[model samples]
Target chain A: MTTRTVAASKSGKLLNKLFPYLLLAPAFILVIVLNYIPIGESVLRSLYDWRGGSRATFVGLANFKELFQDMAFHISMKNMIKLLVFQLVVILTVPLLAAEYIFRLKNHPVLQNAFRVLFVLPMVVPRIVTVLIWQFIYDGDVGLLNGILKGLGLVSLARPWLDDPRLALYAIMFVGFPWVSGVATLIYLAGLENVESTVWDSCELDGARGLRRVFAIDIPLIFAQLRTMAVLTVIEVIGGYMFVDILVLTGGGPGWATMVPGLNLYENAFKFSRMGYACAMGLTLSLIALFITLLNMSLFGKKVDE
Target chain B: MRIRREDLIRLLVLGFLAVLTIAPFVITLFISFKTEAQFIRNPFGLSLPLHWSNYATAWAEVRKYLFNSIFACSIACVGALTTATLAAYAFARFSFWLDKFLFYVLMFLIMLPPIMSLVPRFLMVKRLGLLNTYGGLILPFMSGSQVTAMFILRSFFSGINESIFDAAQLDGASEGQILVRIVLPLSAPVLWTLAIMNIMTSWNNILWPLITLSSRELYPVTVGLMFFQGQYAIQRGPLMAGYIISSIPLVLLFMFASKSFIRGLSSGAVKM
Candidate 1:
């Protein structure tokens, strides 16, 4: 085997071993320097009080202390919990049902494929634009919601959906009603497809079809997908601000009713020039997301390869 | 020609949901053609005159921002595609003690939201004198795509028949040649999928571009549209028009590539 390459030396062996690293280096460097390194720096930056282009002054967790004391932050946290609960409930139910409904249309490939395409096609529209379109639909006077209510002769129920602080958060959450994401649906379908044919056949043979088969077999097998959606939504809600920011009527609202931690962190960083404070919130948010991610992996994520 | 009542019921329910899904875009399209006065008079109704001037006006307004977006996002997608392809190939084809460790590290980064490091990233880029330049905006976002794209592409690479590469190697072809000649050609679908995704993420990015590129000229359409809509808050017509301009390309792309695009996002749970 070594005959044709008998002249191989120390450098050749080293180069052979190092070749993979060389190929991997650019991405590794980019990720470390641009993505991962900043994470460490953020932790360091959060401990300092730097603002308005001033020199950094070490503050030793004062930012977090201040964050805890701030009542606005408190409201933001409550709002986030509220949104998270709503998001979790919707995510677990709607997407799974939609996927199941489409999956049951097994005999009709045309219909199944069409519904799948329709469900996912909206993804091409930039999320921000969707938020904006919903903003139009939620408009108090001339908006589609009010127009529909008026058309249905339930005009009394059409009062300023996004304008009322009590209604703003719910209205934002309602934007793309049914909340059955194409991604979640696809993941679920994939999981279902992985169910062994023999297992499914046996279940059918035993008359364990329909909802019973779904609850007993499909749901358990797809528990990993459900857990993934739960973790992803929580992280997304904590990081996202587009919806709240576009609540044009209630811009963090008549009373900070719709304010979320992500939006709050953003406002602090740029709008309030509280860079240090925002960094602290960033770290906290990261830790929360990290904790949830770990919880998911431990609880329901796929078993690790040895 | 006998239709089962159950099948009919399923068809009706499915069709309704499909309509509900497609309606928002349809409404946006019709409303986009309306003049401000017409919208005020009949907000939810069809655009009677079918005024097309709004598109022209919206184009004139957001063209600079659109150019900046295309420039920055495309460059970032290309950068991401290149780096992600290389790293994914390494992870897929080579084995070392550090391979699993490094792969997990990339996944860990993927899991961490950018909110985690938003400020420090800004400062680091600023310190490097990359602030406000297209590269500054492009680089971090490019790196952001590495984890997901690497995961996706690595899985794709690993699925390829390895004997083909072995044959190439036996002919004295280098790893680079094998990757280009054998791997790259086979990787078109995944590559296109990742490229489109990278482009979408880079284009849809707002918070990072907002923080990093404070200069008005360098703003992507998302940031520009945010500010523009904020400026024209009450001008619902013009605002809708701008939203139309921004959405049409993606909507068209989806109409064409919806199958593969949805497949890519669907097959993976960790979509951006």
Candidate 2:
């Protein structure tokens, strides 16, 4: 080959080596537009306090200072933390137990498949549908729950479930119960399925059964799945409360008992028309969420399936 | 042989679990046909009239919302699938210094909750002149690291043998040509799976649309249904109708594609 052709071939080889990077560029650019730039803008806007529109005054940390004095804000934060704790416990236990149970049924393929589908069905259903269905169930007067209780002559136990400040959060919590274990089940089931049958046979020979097998064999095998579910559940609890706002159906009222940061942020930005201050609140909430997620990562990120 | 007591207990447990799981959905299906008054009064009972027209009325009222939802969701799904596939393919088969760093960063992005970016995202969408536009709704969803889709696609893509690439090279196939002609044809199952997932993500997404879309005309089903929630003193009849209508397309889609979607969700469970 002549020098010209050889040079041309070498250049082509270089171009071929870079092709994947070139292909990835479009995705990277979109990420900046979608995630990076907006996050940067949120930080910038967090320092300002202005109404909706082209006008905002940079107030630095004053909005945050005002945040401390706001009782509603404090209640929202406390409620969020409580939710974060309660959800972690409930979501974690149900999934771990169910996943272990399902995994142990390797001999019953049909039942396993049916259970998987049934549990995951709720996740596929939209939140709006879920909220609407539960609202009827939570309805003060004519709800099936209340009706069933009264018909059974347990009138004292039946009350407006969503309206009671003490019980409203729990009403919101139940909305998540349907599909809460799905991801955990999926993860742990996968992990459990991958375990060599010989190991399980040995465990059986050791006379492990039910709760014993679960504690001794099953939990260790799927500790990674447990970690994954824990992190995701926390994120879901913090970011996922938006679904609860719909079910509570109070319009962030009944004395702000059902209000979470998301609804509060939405109201502040759109409903209250305090766009700049909302941005600040949104920024604060975002930081809090990010911190929680990061905390989860630092705690559990390294122990992934790898 | 006598059935063991343990086996009987397992059956009982399974039965109870199934009832718990399926009851809510059965209740929802029943309620879809019930009126607001009927729903409030007897949510569990059979509808007196079995008003299916509520579906029709709900559809008409929320038609724009449905259209907007379909439009936004379709665009986001298509965009996410296309971009994620390309990125995933590159990450799966190719190696370079930047690849590992980019992959790790993407993983970090996945860990960051969507709410963390809500305000910033809204501002960016507004500034880009995409507010209330399909592009704005699509971009955040389609491009926001889409970690789950990328993970699924990457795992599937990596499973293909290296010999295929060598064989394609011997045939004088370009990289893009191999991706399009060979890899894509073989990866149809996963591609379709991710497509369903992307569709679901876009369809169920409410928070992003809540902030970005200003006009009623731009409202998707999730936001559109909110209109009926308060506008007529909680018109539960039309609202239930609206829920039924919005849900029909999704349910139909899932009924046909659920097997693959279930496989996909479970397939990535190992990674998650």
Candidate 3:
């Protein structure tokens, strides 16, 4: 009770902490088992030329070489790049413009919430429902588009939208444009709301017209939202293009017109049972997506945390 | 504040958006009430004889899948919320050697595109005898999504003042007691936000469940919709009806929680 008691008294003034690490133990274990473990397994599998077999030869990088040789794989790469560009334009432009309008009208809560709910409905809707709904809209014989075209005296141009290889990818992209607009619009709404009302008032007082005020005050603040949306849209398109393969009724048909990376990866893994090759495809697509995301972050995103 | 010609243009643009947004659901609704014969005959037109019975039929067909989805969604929500909240509390309140490194690891996990690990996850789940179980279906998504919940909760918990923890400590509160009594009560809003977001994700996730759950009884509504499409390849009635039933919960959720959900997603995105 001499020195030991004195030391305990001094240290006891500090708060005792235990079991803090215990709180994190479960999450740490689960991620290791689920995510990192699979990543490791895929790496190991990538070294083998196994086709779901008991016996296989280890051919490191052979799968990558074969993937490069496949013409469809090359096209998938090109199409992915094209999609990244197209998405950047469509998703970025509409939200930047729409956020300005929504910001100007922020005083009206009812109208604001009404439009927001409507737009974001598609974002929340199950992907298959959207796909099926659009599939009906794009149908050939009795679709909404053809019926409207015929009614509007444009029957000459009413044609099968998904059957043509040249137009098939665009038709698929059409479905994406609206499905994603809701999230961007919401992001814009949030960004615009964050801009001080006084700033807009000042711009207005300085003879800034509607569009001019938007450019002068609104875009800069909302640019962060725009960059975030652009990266998300690119990643989404790359990951979500597989759903297009399901809905467009083409299954990347008319000679692989709408064959995006996800669909290609799916076919390779499941149908072809080339686990190694499929892993290569997945790794490649992920790297490209990562590169684009990093590029956008550096170019447009602010260094500060949100 | 005056209603200029430009104001009218803005309103018109919003009008166009309204139509574009709601048109698909409207189309799906109309076709859902149509007869199969009418649907196949004119997929785009009004039903020759309106047939609302298709909904009952479709529901009976996929009710098992719907039930499974509800069960799995609940499991994931509970699992994710508990684990994320616990870890977030530790990271927010404590000073530890590995805290920063672990936090950065969680961030890295969030950035990963899930499809990259799909093949390996499938193989692992299969080998674990969880191929068609509810545990298999919900566990992977829960594990994958915890990064987000941890991030959100960590941000929220760190905002609480340190004095509260000190006071609780002076009141003879143990770490477990402080967590249960103080931290949880103060973090309700963030918890609700995480719940709504996770519920939506659980409801809408397709690709992972599609690959893992092979038994029809184990499929979620998102994957179950694919079956509707497969069975009704030429008919739109059941297909449209399926869409209507499957999407009602989400539509209602959006209608009710639109503001909170939008704020959550935007805030989450901006942070990332």
Candidate 4:
């Protein structure tokens, strides 16, 4: 009986050691098969000349070479750069301003919560629906923007907002008007809440009033949150599928005016069956994203240390 | 007895911004209830004879896609949360040989943009014969979301009182029992938040489903709305109604679990 009990305890110890691995197996298997393998395959396939299904002949660097010379790709890159600048600016300003406003009303908890809920309410709407609603708003005839402009007696300025190539890209950028993103505002609010009451007391004692107080205390206190938002905005603008928006809104435009790199990549792979070229574009875009992210981290890391 | 000038000015500014933020949605709702003639007469304002039939027409078109979206998103959310929770528990509670290595591997994936693997993943899914099936959608979503879910869950699980876990272990409870009974119960709020975030992302996704599913029956609401818009380009009332109908599930989710929804949105910022 003693021997049997000892043997049972030994096996139980073995089982205890194996348990964590057993738990990890499911997620690991799925991640390996789905994410890691595909990423490896993407890197390999980008070097080959293949139409997705047929035998891929290795043509080293040719696809990348072609991508560099592609005029449409150049246009998309320029449009993306323009978009990135605009998005970063909007993200830094609008949501921070809104969060600061909400943060100032901390004494009035009821009003603070009300504003928080209202600001986040729009985010529950599906993004596609948001884009489509904007599509209708930018419609040539019987659209809200045009109707409002005409209502205000600015008839000359009420031309088809989306149909005009010069205005289409800007219109797409302006989809969520006033651009107070819920996520950004919430993040800033959380950051603002983290500031010690003692810090606030010192600022008040120093007589840092109005914009002086904001510039001196509020912005610096939320620098970490600002960095986070900046990085997120970069990833979003770079890696997001403007393909869907462009497809729904302009189909890359009245002549490649709004042709973003993501849409261009989609068109190459699926629409034109240039899968290899698309892979190269995807690789390039991802590298650019990775580079920018690292740059952002290092830059902010230095500032925070200082 | 009276509002301060500064406070009043702040209130006006915030109120004005709130109106601007919600104006598009409010306008969509009004237009959804208007007749085509009514919309044409006054595109930006409320009109008479609330046309409820537009919703019926829109519902007829949108119901299938909504069903597909709910079915797929729920599966993906639950699948991701379950797998991620188990993995996170192991990472949080145990110090095994491969623990640090595996954690780093998963963390590295968070930096790799999903768009990089788009083309190859599509090809692989096609080769596996999962293109139009629900598996193609659910599996990728589950895999893609696990890293973030695991990241969040592991941190939350780690912060729990270690003594409770030890006490449960000393009671001769197996690892599974300890997890299900102690860890999971302790971390319900975080799990709830993660589940809601997963569902919201799956619901909003368009590009993947659009590429994978060719059949009209398999289309999610996002893809369905695209085709719906194309077909109903001129029918403003029903088109606007379709947009609103597509949004109702998420809006309803927000209404019912506003606290969890808000928490989930903010928790996402904690990823970095």
How well does model 4 score by local distance difference test?
A: 0.86
For model 2, the docking class works out as medium
Best by TM-score: 4
Weakest ten-residue segment in model 1 chain A by summed lDDT = A241-250
DockQ of each: 0.56, 0.49, 0.55, 0.62
Consecutive 10-residue window with the lowest summed lDDT within model 2 chain A: A239-248
Q: Rank the candidates by TM-score, best first.
A: 4, 1, 3, 2
Residues B64-137 of candidate 1: C-alpha lDDT, one tens digit per residue: 98888888887888888888899989999999769999888888876788778887788789888999898899
- Per-residue lDDT tens digits for candidate 1, residues A65-132, read 99999898899888888888888898888778878777777668788888887887777677778777
Question: Which candidate leads the pack in DockQ?
Answer: 4
Q: What TM-score would every model get versus the actual structure?
A: 0.93, 0.90, 0.91, 0.96
Better of 1 and 3 by DockQ: 1
Q: Between which residue pairs do clashes occur in model 2? A: none
- For B101-207, candidate 3 gives per-residue lDDT tens digits of 98887777655677777788888888888888988888887898788898878888888898999999999998889888999888765676677778877777777
User: Candidate 4, which segments miss by more than 4 Å at Cα?
Assistant: A302-306, B264-271
Tens-digit lDDT string for candidate 4 (B1-272): 36678778878989999999999999999999988788778776888789999999999999999999999999999999999998988898899997999988887777677888899899888988999999999999999888889988888888888788789878999778888888888777677767777898888888899899989999999999888888898888998999998888988877878786566555543534
Better of 3 and 4 by TM-score: 4
Model 3 / residue B49 / CA error / Å: 7.0
